[model samples]
Every structure is written in structure tokens, then in C-alpha cells.
Target: MPIGRADVSPPHWRKSSYSNGSGGACIEVADNLPHTIPVRDSKNPTRTPLLFTPDAWASFVTAVAIGRLAD
Candidate 1:
């Protein structure tokens, strides 16, 4: 049997630690993909996930952690 495109695995999405059970605002991230991290709104999983390179993702995470990107 030939392998099909749809046979590919889907991303394993995890909610951000900062997210709360109330669901006011939340984003899920898939860190399983090689060299890529995908993020999407938890309330809208069917939407296209935003892809980020490993390095870029790392930098963005660091900035957020240190409050450089905070409002």
C-alpha cells in the first residue's frame, strides 16, 4: 500500500502554563515537530498554526520570560 499525505501525524498541542481553566485567553503550542514550533489559539484549533523556527521560538520565549515583550 502506498503511503498517503493524510497518514502524517498531527501536532500534539499543549496549553500555555499561564492559561487558566476559565478560558479567557489561551494559546496551544506544538513542540513535537522537528525544527519548528506551531502555535494556535486554543479556542480555534482548526485555524492555521503559526510556525516558528526553533531559534526564533527560543528568542521569543526568552523575551516573554524576561518581560521584554510585556505590555
Candidate 2:
């Protein structure tokens, strides 16, 4: 439900700092473009990424860091 036009410039994806050292199951995030954070699975780089607004991405990161998403 994002309203503004999403910047479509090619993203330079970077692996999460917390990713497994062996490149196992992990997520990559692209912070290059404006107003968007592109996230994709390392196991499937060719697949479309899930886009999140800056605010939303920050919130999600905070939640994860605080163990709010733990099972």
C-alpha cells in the first residue's frame, strides 16, 4: 500500500551482518536506492525482492534485535 513511486534504480545488495559465515540461509538488503529497502533471500538471488519503506525496515530491525519475533 505504498503511495509514492518507488525508485527503480538497480540495487547493490549486501548480506546481513548477522548472516551465516558459510552463506547458508540468509537475507540480503539493498540500501542504495531512495525510499526503499530491497530484501531478497540469499538462496534465490534471481527472485524478486520484498521492498520495504525506510521506516518500516527500521521498525522490523528493531523488533528483531529485541527478540520480539522469537518463537
Candidate 3:
């Protein structure tokens, strides 16, 4: 379940709602991955994806949304 390598396959991909419409810098998430959540750079969809637990991903997303974690 280690999709951190240079060639990971995402079953699905979804861009963040906060992504710039013009496509500057954006991050995407691929869910429905059972116990894991796959994340990748939209700018490089063909590359490796960072995997995380569903809870962890949710926490991160919540934190980001609430401004608890700053970029």
C-alpha cells in the first residue's frame, strides 16, 4: 500500500476546491482507496502520489480548511 514511489496509480483524482482556476499551483486527492488516501500534485499527475490514512487525510483537510494549519 506504499504509493510513495515514482510510479503510483490513482484509481481516481479530485482537485482541491481551493485550487486556482487558472492552474497556478494545485494539489489533488484521490479517495475511495479503501484504508488509504492518495494525494498528488496536479501539475504532475503522472508521478508518484503521497498516501495517507483516511483519518489522517481528513484531519489535514479539516485543519487546512479551518486555518489551523497554514501553508
Candidate 4:
């Protein structure tokens, strides 16, 4: 689901630790909502965010943790 500014409540956005603070490849995630994980570009806060299901998000994170996404 696409999340517009008005579609979501106040989001507590957390930046990725891998972000070097160089204004490059930075993404923010808000997982406080039930059943959905919202992701947005850190540089473009005004834009709509992409929403992921909890299961999909967990699988993606697990793949990243195991370095399977690199292949």
C-alpha cells in the first residue's frame, strides 16, 4: 500500500545504522504501526512512503542479515 502524508499517523522514523550521514543511500523506517512497515527516503520526507506487510518485511530483513540479498 502507498502511504500518503495524510494516510499515516505520526510516524517515529528511524534511520538505518548503515547510513553514513553523507546524504547518500539513506532510508528511514517506521515500524510502530500494526501490520505494516513504512519505508521512505530520508532525503525526501514530503513524498509518500512505501508500505510492506510485516511478514514480507521480516523476510527481507532476514535475507539482508544473511547476505542473501547480495546474490
User: TM-score of each candidate?
Assistant: 0.81, 0.81, 0.78, 0.80
lDDT of 2 at 19: 84
Q: Assess each prediction's global lDDT (C-alpha) against the native.
A: 0.84, 0.89, 0.82, 0.84
State the lDDT of candidate 2 residue by residue for 14-66, as single tens digits: 99987898878699999998888999999899999998988999999999899
lDDT of the structure predicted as candidate 4: 0.84
Question: Residue-wise lDDT of candidate 3 within 5-47, one digit each (tens)?
Answer: 4434546888989889998779898886677788889999889
What pairs collide in candidate 2?
Answer: none
Clashing pairs in 4: none
- TM-score-based ranking: 1, 2, 4, 3
lDDT of 1 by residue, 1-71 (tens): 23442224578999999677898679999888766689999999899989898799999999999999997
**Candidate 3 residue 24 C-alpha distance from true site, Å:** 1.6
Q: What count of clashes does model 1 give?
A: 0
lDDT, candidate 4, 10-51, per-residue tens: 778999886677899899999888767899999998799998
Candidate scoring better on TM-score of 2 and 4: 2
TM-score of 4: 0.80
User: Of the candidates shown, which would achieve the greatest lDDT relative to the real structure?
Assistant: 2
Per candidate, the number of residue pairs that clash is 0, 0, 0, 0
Runs in model 3 lying further than 4 Å from the true structure: 1-10
